[model samples]
Target: MLTELIEIIKDTFLPTIVVTGDTALKTDLALDSFEIINLIGILEDKYKIEINVIDIVSLITLEDICNYIANKKMP
Candidate 1:
């Protein structure tokens, strides 16, 4: 999940992981509301899971996303 999220960040944002870690999604990535929405859509389609908008709002870093994805996968 971390690797996939890293790839998404690299493809979506020009910033490398060096400057931003997990939190880069909200900070260094500079992703706006629309971008976040698009990202959620991409993730949902690729992961085959339904993501709530509230989750997106609460997410602030790469670790957050990774943890969220992991939690969703757990039984």
Candidate 2:
């Protein structure tokens, strides 16, 4: 799941640096507000889960996003 998330982020931004769980979405990834919004939509569609705005705001690192989607997935 983490790998997939990293792939998504790379696909979205085409980052040239290595992305890790500790990488900050805003500072490390340099994701702007628009990109963040787009990411939320992408994640929702990819994971088939509704990601609320509050949840989006709470995500600080790549790991947070991976864990949130994992927890939200239907069994």
Candidate 3:
């Protein structure tokens, strides 16, 4: 799941630098508000789960997003 998320991010942002789970989303990925919305939409479609804006705003790092999706996948 993490690898998939990384691939999505890479494809979306086309970052020239390497990205890791600990990377800060805003500072490192430089994702703007529109890109963040796009990410959430992609994640929802990929994971088949609903993610709210508040949940997205709370995410601080790539790991946070991965963990959020993992937890949502749990019954």
User: How much lDDT does each candidate structure score?
Assistant: 0.75, 0.88, 0.87
Candidate with the greatest TM-score versus the true structure: 3
Off by over 4 Å in 1: 15-21
Report the lDDT tens digits of candidate 2 across residue range 1-75. 888888898888865779989988899888898999999999999888998897788899999988888889857
Question: Candidate 1 at 30: error in angstroms?
Answer: 0.8
Highest lDDT among the candidates is held by which one? Answer: 2
Question: Candidates' TM-scores?
Answer: 0.82, 0.91, 0.92
Candidate 1 residue-wise lDDT, 1-75, digit = tens? 777777887787654555334465656777888888888888888888888877887778878877888788788
Identify the superior model by lDDT, candidate 2 or candidate 3. Answer: 2
Better of 2 and 3 by TM-score: 3
Question: For model 1, what is the error of residue 49's alpha carbon versus the real structure, in angstroms, after optimal superposition?
Answer: 0.8
Clashing pairs in 2: none
RMSD in order of candidates: 2.0, 1.2, 1.0
Model 2 accuracy (lDDT, Cα)? 0.88
